[model samples]
Target: MELMTFESPVNAVLSGQEAPERSLKRRVPMTARTKQLSDKEMDALERQIPDLAQIATKTAYARALLVSDSVLRVDSGDLVRISLDGSKTVVAKAEPRRKVKVGEVITVRRIEDQTAGGRA
Candidate 1:
């Protein structure tokens, strides 16, 4: 005996154009919804945040005062008075060998350095 192989016919039956023995199944439908919150509810949610009182408050040091445009041309041991921003005055103990002369542009620069003793 010999085996036989044949190709299926390409017509309405293979393409599903004709009615089949059973009907096809249908897919289920889906739906979604969103809700809005009231102002009171939103405020209650905001209240959950912690209050950082200490973090908000900070301490700062007093700034150095600046000298006027006119320089003080005085010899050693000459006491000079300079006006500061807050209607205050700074008495600069003059040194004999200062490079600045009177009527010269002067700027006061204050530098604070740390000592090995750990005192500022």
Candidate 2:
């Protein structure tokens, strides 16, 4: 008895040989979820927070600034709070496992509603 092996068309091409004739799937380019901010908008945001101006020049950091809903300030013991619509919202609670310095910027998402008593 003899065993037969199969190789993908991609592997054949990588080995410097032509792939056997078969239907090929069309590839499409993926689009980014977040878009870069315009120069005017970037200037305005930089004016608000001069410190971010240096980071905003980079592609990744610039996109984050545009997409984030709110940025919070971290307090001692890893506490973070965000203010929206004239109300203060707690984004992160103090964690005994970690220590964060005061005045550090932190990004957080709501995993569960605090009003629900931490129930998912």
Best by TM-score: 2
The digit string of per-residue lDDT tens for model 2 on 13-119 reads 33433435433444433543677899999889878875554544443332332335333445665554433233445656676665668998878776655533442
Cα deviation of 71, candidate 1, in Å = 53
Error of 1 at 33 (Å): 4.0
Give lDDT: candidate 2, residue 78. Answer: 50
Candidate 1: RMSD over Cα atoms? 34.8
TM-score for candidate 1, please give it.
0.15
**TM-scores, all models, native as reference:** 0.15, 0.24
Q: Tell me how candidate 2 scores on lDDT.
A: 0.49
Which structure among the candidates has the greatest lDDT?
2
Please state every model's RMSD to the true fold in angstroms. Answer: 34.8, 18.4
lDDT of each: 0.37, 0.49
